[model samples]
Target: MAVMDDSRLAEELRLTIGRLVRTVRAVDTMPPGEAAVLGYLDRGGPLTTAEIAQQRGVSHQSAAKTVKGLLTQGLVRVEAHPDDGRKLLLTLTPAGHDRLAEERRRRADRLGRAINAVLTPDERKTLEAALPLLSRLSTHGTGE
Candidate 1:
């Protein structure tokens, strides 16, 4: 194996991951922002638009626009916050659940096919071994 410094490894990881994400995302049927909103709602929702913006690391305006599109598509529903009457919370609709599931299935299929096609058995093992580390790195990515 070629020697790599920390910075070099970081750069390589960042670039390769970025490209891979783009490749996987290319198969998505919905816009990324909308898909993201659905995912957030699925995971930790009944969230206000401001909370969504904070979680997504976007401006309130951007998050609101995404919410609007989701609402229009019937993927998300808004309701009054339990504690705060003035604030509204968003929840994923049944359609939203199905849509999010489909989106995940499509991306997983795309990535799984590519992984099988491109990697040898040993390489596959190595990649699987790296998954935990990658997950940790991802967690640290959220300003943790």
Candidate 2:
């Protein structure tokens, strides 16, 4: 096979990945902002609203709006910060864990079905083989 241009490959890969994300997100049961907050809290709980805003790359008010909805839905709870009384720490509740798990399972099941329907066994293997490389590449994603 002929060698592909690196720049062209990068552009194509970026666009394709963006499209894939959009397609998968179509199955989301909740707004992406709320789901993202739930995911971050699950992975790193007891974070402050400021931290959530940083992680989300959104303004504090934007993160607050999402957190407010989660609070009303009983998916998250806020507690006074141990180190700083002025700020509140956010953590997922039991219901929040259940909801996040259900959401993940639903998305995974949909993706799994699509994969089974669309890809041949060898193609599936090839995609699986790319996962580690993709993961490694993503480690550079947060570089400033």
Candidate 3:
């Protein structure tokens, strides 16, 4: 096989991955903004609206709207911040936790099936072998 330049190969790989992600079946019941908020809370625990917005890369007003919807759904609860009386901290309720877990499981199952369909056994093994490198790339700047 001819050796390709690393940058060109990486860009091609990224485009392929992007196409795969865009084509995946998503859970349509939950809006993207709400799902993002829930995912952040699931990973980082309780946070104030400002913190959530920062984590989500969204405006404060956008985060507020997402939080309002979550509150209306009884998926999140607000409490007085111990350090700051004026700002409220938001945490996922039991219902929210359960919902996020279910969503994750569903997406994992879908992805597994899709991957199995597309790749041969050897290719799948090769992809698994590259996971560590991919993870390193993912954590390079985010301080994960």
- Model 1, span 1-144: residue lDDT tens: 989999999999999999999999999999999999899899886899999999889999999999999999999999989998999999999999999999999999999999999999999999999999999999995765
RMSD of each: 1.4, 1.6, 1.5
Q: Write the number of the candidate with greater lDDT, choosing between 1 and 2.
A: 1
Error of 2 at 21 (Å): 1.0
- TM-scores for all candidates? 0.94, 0.94, 0.91
Clashes of each: 0, 0, 0
- Each candidate: what lDDT? 0.95, 0.93, 0.87
lDDT: worst 10-residue window of model 1: 135-144
- The residue ranges of model 2 lying beyond 4 angstroms of the native Cα positions read 141-144
Tens-digit lDDT track for model 3 on 43-128?
98889999998888899999999999999999999999999899899999999998888877877787899889999999999999
Please list all clashing residue pairs in model 3, or write none if there are none. none
- Cα error of candidate 3 at position 31, Å: 1.1
Once fitted onto the true fold, the runs of candidate 3 whose alpha carbons sit more than 4 angstroms away are none
Clashing pairs in model 2?
Answer: none
So what's the TM-score on candidate 3?
A: 0.91
